[model samples]
Target chain A: MNDRKTTQDWMKDWQALQRQYWTAWADATRGASGEAPDPATPWHEGLEQWARLFGDASKQSETAERLLATAKNYVALMQSMLAAATGKAAGDAAAPAWTEALRNGLNLPGLDAALHDNPLARMLRELRGPGAQAIDQLSASFAPFLARAREEGLAWLGAPALGYTREHQEHYQKMAAALLDYQDAVNRYNALVLKASRRSFEIFEDKLAERDEPGRRIETLRALYDLWVDAAEEAYAEVALSAEFRKVYGNVVNAQMRVRSQIQQEVERIGVDLGMPTRSELNSVHQRLHELRRTLRRRDDDALVELRRELERLRTEVEALRRRPAQAKPAAARSAARKAVKTGNARK
Target chain B: MGPIHIDPQRAVAELTTFNQKLAAGLKTLRSLDEVDYGATPREAIYREDKLVLYRFRGETSPTAKTPLLIVYALVNRPYMVDLQHDRSLVRNLLARGEDVYLIDWGYPDLSDRYLTLDDYINGYIRRCVEAVAKRCNVEKINLLGICQGGAFSLCYASIHPQTIRNLITMVTPVDFHTPDNMLSHWTRGMDVDLFVDTLGNVPADLMNWCYLTLKPVRLFQQKYVGLVDILDNKEEVENFLRMEKWIFDSPDQAGEAFRQFIKDFYQANKLVNGGLRIGESEVNLRNITMPVLNIFAEQDHLVPPSASRPLQQHIGTQDYTELAFKGGHIGIYVSGRAQREVPAAIHDWLAAR
Candidate 1:
């Protein structure tokens, strides 16, 4: 009990010293350059004047209200300091004692009159003749009640302030760092997805020849088709869900869909004969021959000779195909015939 | 020869036959493989190792004091100006007794990738102009530039005003800030450096793709579909093929020159601001004191009227006239409607001067 009393006394002396230092600082900053200090001009009066000159009406009224609240707080702080110094219970002090002292010692009635005389209040009075007086009276009456409430409010909140500061700061820092890390991870994932999507198509193209069997080729083609469709869906999901990537990457997805559609249609049209040569294929071969002839003209003797032989072979094959009856033949039988003819011609 | 009197009906038939034969001859010539740069043509007039200037003489003895020099854009072969007997701007000018000279910008090869503005302006253009002057034995020549070549000619005329007596620009963009021009906006945002670095010279195929994309729906669908209506007419079919050939036969632009053009003209808007520099000399619009004729198509999507309007105000020339025609960019040269109005207007304007 004695130790508690001693701690209270120390707090009282510290608060008094703090008040004196703040009052002196405010005076030095807000001093008149050459005029003598007038006892008639209270500190609040100077504060009101500065607020009127340097601040607008709406803001100045708010400042005035804030200043009144601070004055009430100062009175409560003094009471607490006194309680600490005297080793007296806070509740034992007279009810409304600090409020009454603050009202009388600070010249509250005169200050209230000064606040009404302010430009903003004057304008309100002109705007609403007798209503302004009623408002002023009501506000003056409520000021003490508000100050007491503020004092009690600060006492209630003071216990948790230090704990909240450390806990909230650390939690916020961790959350912020985690959010940044998540963003980096998402970016890397998007890049990998894009690269993997591109490589998937390349892999499909490379493995196309590995599936030489008809059934295997069909299965492989279907898989390739599914891969394209799956890639497009994945790109859409990744790009659409991401806020930063949606706009820039949307066109790439659209282009991929278009190219995929074209490939699908072309693959469907090519169908079972994807590996076999057709009439148009032979025409393309002939077209290449013609192109070579046009390009080389009389020059390139070896190329010309090779092109002439190819042209004669193409002509003979086309004639044979035309002469053949319009009857179905087995693909195996045709292949065997082609092999035998090729070997015989080579031997000859 | 004196005007030969003949029956009106007979004259019409003969003229029609003559036109058909002329068109056939032009078609045959156009079908032949295009002459490569530095390759000798079967027939030639003025030939340098790097460049060639073709002169087609007029039927009438040349009487106009000022010779007209047609500068075609490097994007295409200059044969669009001499497409056929009916649609040929060169033949029309020759018929009007104006001495004509065309600048043929031959196809640039891989070695020509580093060719700079100095090489074009000082070497090819200057030599061509000097040749025209030397051939005419005249101090000044009238310049008519078409499309991109129009812009080049404007810069050339501004830098060398004494050589050009009168300047005519058709469907040329000077102010690139027009909001309606989609091509300008698309190109303004392009990564030109990345594109140029990857491809030594911008491939004509890629350039063609970009142009086609501007109006994909129209170029890919409506154009070919509309051809069905004209397939019955042999004349129309031939004309269609000729135009198609011209449209697709794009030449690759020199890489460095294209880079500078896009940077200096489209993005910076330096040409109109008098901040354009070709080699050591600055191109000043104030230096262009010659009479100017600014022709633009009212319906041109590539080079809108706004792109060509600011030229009249910026140039120091006192005598300036603007002729806005109802057509697209290519229509200014080849459209049947423009053939009568545009060419006649140009002839009258040239004759009056």
Candidate 2:
């Protein structure tokens, strides 16, 4: 990614750019003097005063310089990653020896060497280990319900009076399959999650065992953090990207929705039998009322806006009149004119 | 074990440092006055439902003829741009002499469950834009959108290209089907209707959990650890806590909008594939012929750079400029680099345009 530009070349260019930025910033601020500052706004004026008092110019300069240096470091890190990733550096200045050496063995975010050494991730794994079992137990408890739902759905659909047609049979079969599919999908998703977690633990445990003699598994917080991020991103990406996960997820949701629809239909059917309004009727009413409310809201808002505009215009006019020069010849009759205007038309 | 390869003294020192940091953190938290943010002086221009349109009163008179209207995402508070006194995007723009206006999409509840993308883009955002323009007495306005708000802006701009003079999208996801787009990936197969129906308005906690688990180890764990490292520095600690507050303070999404977005954008990739419709209006990216500035985070996990990078290719705007920021999703807004680089770049670009 770096096109083999050494750290020194990159930092020098970066510093030059930083100097340019400061220069431009200074020039721009200097230019601001030509434009009049608005002090009528208290908060903005306060901010300006506060900034001036705090010597924001000097502080901002210092901040800019520091941030540039940080940016330079970031550039260097990205370069290092690139060099490490490509496994080939045409130039002599490569990533630091340790990073480069570590690069060859690391697959990262999935099966990375660092995943084994991440202490915090390991600790979290240990903490969540028991939760895995709880999920399994919960899934087991939920199974019977799903099975019963599947059976009842199939039996209901297969009833001779409802339909002896081929379409009915197909529908029943599909419903039964979907019900089972929902459970299977949930189990699969859970298993994938478990598998990912297991992978991390296995790597972490094995490393811990191997490095038991060294007792130096985790070198630094940064290292541990890098490892943990990789492990997490990898595990998540694996389960998330897999077709099985995607299909199963869709299946589970579709089945759930289908089941809910069925229940709602049944409820509506019951409601019709009892001569009562169903959810559909209520929903239609809600839709109409919602539309009406929205329309009223829009009209009210427009009216209010117009009123506000008119009020503002009147206020502006009043202010303009207050600042106007005193009237000349007609001023002699001003009192009479005002009284006449307030009451009725003045006599010719 | 060979004289304990790891030095016990080092571990002791680490523990001691941790304790010191914890004590300092507690003291800092106690001393903190109310952390008031969105510090730039602003006046409420318009309000509809929970959405508020605010116009910032800058220190200097606006240099631009047209006002810049910021459309923030619905999922979070819009105060992120105007986050703090020094670290405010609004403040910097205001300082730059740009007339800045932002749409604050307040926390949506169950009442807003029926709010579709059409209502957001066509109704709320459209009305907000019109208000800004009318208030400024301008024919058109500069539009700046952040993340999901950017997407909305794109839709709005496409639908009513006449209203937008210049368009700027920051960390906005355009191509939802990009390989690195994890959110899209997870939602790709989701039964959106079922999901939305089941939870009238998707719970903030569940959504937050999904976001957190994106990089479970880093965002959920490593971030707090990093906070601990900076605990001794009271200012840093405060900043950390402020960000922490912002991170968790997410609003439940309007169900209809979320459903449509996930299904059409994520699942079907209709936005890129040319079948995205908001209400009765068809969203044609080709309709957006305005000068476009697309800024994205290089390290943005939420909306990956690749996801945002494809806009130039899809949009009909010949005057397209892609400014790739070297920071993560949030960092692009609040980072030190963002403070100096992003606002200045935007101001200069807008000024030139």
Across A48-151, the per-residue lDDT of candidate 2 in tens digits comes to 32234334344123222222322222223232332332332222222233233233223223433433434333323323423233433544575686567666
Q: Considering every candidate listed, which one attains the maximal TM-score?
A: 2
Question: What is the fraction of true interface contacts found in candidate 2?
Answer: 0.11
Candidate 1's TM-score: 0.47
Model 2, C-alpha of A89: deviation from truth (Å): 34
Q: Write the per-residue lDDT of candidate 1 for residues A218-237, one digit (tens) a residue.
A: 21211322333333334333
Supply every candidate's count of residue pairs whose N, Cα or C atoms clash at under 3 angstroms: 0, 2
Contacts from the true interface found in each model, as a fraction, amount to 0.00, 0.11
**Per-residue lDDT value at A67 in model 2:** 26
Q: Assess every candidate by TM-score.
A: 0.47, 0.65
- Which pairs in model 2 have colliding backbones? A109-A230, A109-A234
On DockQ, the leading prediction is: 2
DockQ of candidate 1? 0.00
Model 1 segments more than 4 A misplaced: A1-348, B1-45
What is the per-residue lDDT of model 1 for residues B1-353, given as tens digits with 9 covering 90 to 100?
A: 10111122232233233223322332333343432221111123466544678766766766787888888887777788777667877777777777777877878765566666655774567668888888888888889988888888888998889899889998889987666666666556455665454355666765665566444324443354344335445566667667877777788888777878878888777878668898767888888899899999998877889999889888899999999999998888888877777767777888887
